[model samples]
Target chain A: MGGEYLANLADSLVTVMDKMAGLTCEWSEKAPQLPAITEGVTVVSLLGFTGAEKGRVVMEMDIETAQKIGEALNQEELGPFDKMIFYALSELSNIFCGAAITQINNGPRRPGLRLTPPNILVGEGLEIFGERAHLETASVFWEGGLIYIHLSLEGGAAL
Target chain B: MIREHLQVFAKASSDVFASLGVQAVHQAPLAPPDSFFSRYDLAIIVGLARDLRGSVVYSMDTETALALAGQMMGGMSLPGLDEMVKSAVCELGNMCAGSSVCNLPGLTADITPPTLITGSKLAIMAGSDNVLMTEIATSFGTVEVRLGLEE
Candidate 1:
């Protein structure tokens, strides 16, 4: 995937989040994708890859921080990263992908972007995709809180 | 306050998506007061408040989302709302909010965490003393959201 395309995708993500989601997140295309640790893995949001390109965007956030947002977002009493918690996440990815499509569709250059729904992987262990793929990510932080955003775009040109 | 917010947001979401070749109607004749998909459906929504309070999102089940995504795909069955699908839908919610965030002045917004919920028995945490559960029946499925706000 071209850097411009990825930058478009990441910028699209920040734009949607800012204009749509009411979040004060900053997307830094300047950073590299965080490596999923093998020793102590955390909860991960694994979304599918599609488009005039192929690959996925994986998000890893500390559970404590998730609970902080969950506290504000959750309506019923329970813990963080619960089964239903994925709903909160699923919707995020859905809208993100939707915005991405909107950009690629409207962009001056035709990149042909396609996307699938996101899945929240609760299990641990280092999971990576596309060995020869180039990595680009945005370090999303809100109020000094940490939420890791990783975009894994692998080989291919179409969905 | 959150309940009213959802209704307002939902209305705005429907309105915006309508312009983008999306017709989001409430579940009435199409789904009904209580649809079969309700039992198997799960919705998770998150909001952002930066330039404005973002629209509250409701991410329901893939079984339900796939039906919608399939249409976005122009008629193609997928194994379910996987990585790309989920994020796309999340982005849909994001777009809807952007479409109308400015209407709610005094706060800018953005969305984060496209977390996925796959299983049943969703126990949401209601920290407030009083929580209102709004049974929002939509064309896709029944959207149950817990609203908590002071003032």
Candidate 2:
């Protein structure tokens, strides 16, 4: 995957987050530090994509940040780490992934990328494997908290 | 129809575990649990569409998940359910569901991405009552498999 494709994908994610959750997000100029598990309870959602590009996109944030986003979207206070909050986060990740894939395949070269339903992980001390792959990470500041979006493209070129 | 589907799923589960070098034996089918809460701490739900419209949930406790993940990673010691372990478990569920769909002849359906839920005393409402519940005994621990299909 080209850097331009990854940049477009990051832009698309920010757009979706802004529109869906009413949260202002932009790609951080400098690489932000990944939150330590001890900082708070973290929730990570993974969505795998296949077609012209094969890899996984991960959305990570603290539980408090997730609840805030969910409450804003639903306009209701949600319990910390509640199932509803998890579902909302999952749906948000789904939309973000869908939009990013569409943005990547918008040009003349169609990736024909298809996304799988999101898989969510709610816990601390989580580490994903993609060491030998092309990894692109984007950190966005939202409402004083940071949301990390990582795209790991593995062994696929734009068709 | 349910039995046929169960057979495919059971074979798939066995094959997946065998591939990971872990022996898993199909146990007797059990009655569906009234509440998923307090039953297991970690669960992976794989949604199926088309000919069979529903989900397949693989439930196990935290220890079982850690053990399974360790085995999947060639017996690497895991302190907690980190990202790597979680991904390994999710991939296992994906593989099992993919194999089941492939083995079930004439069952045209698509598999959704696997969803992993981890918490204590969690409750999940199935879409339908038509569920095939079975237990599998593995060297590490027991895994409860619930296949819920919409009629």
Candidate 2 stretches greater than 4 Å from native: A32-38, A130-132, A156-159, B1-7, B18-22, B28-98, B107-135, B144-151
Index of the highest-DockQ prediction: 2
Across B1-151, the per-residue lDDT of candidate 1 in tens digits comes to 4544545555666665455444566432211112112233344433342332222335455565665555556646768646566655555544555554545445444433322344333233221223344443445554443322223
Model 2, A1-159: lDDT tens per residue?
545655776787788878887788888535543333224466776666666655667677877888888787777988986777777877787787778778777877787776655555555444344422455667777765777876666653431
Least well predicted 10-residue stretch by lDDT in candidate 2 chain B = B120-129
TM-score quality measure for candidate 2: 0.69
- Please, what are the lDDT tens digits per residue for candidate 2 over residues B108-128? 766656656665444443324
Error of 1 at B13 (Å): 41
lDDT of 1 by residue, A1-159 (tens): 455555655666566555644557676656545555322435555544443455556666655655554454455554755644555655665676667666766778665554444444443333333233455666666673555666655543321
DockQ of each: 0.03, 0.17
Poorly placed runs, candidate 1 (over 4 Å): A15-21, A37-41, A75-78, A156-159, B1-151
Q: Name the 10 consecutive residues with the lowest summed lDDT in model 1 chain B.
A: B29-38
> What is candidate 1's local distance difference test score?
0.48
Candidate 2, pairs of clashing residues = A126-B83, A127-B83, A127-B84, B37-B122
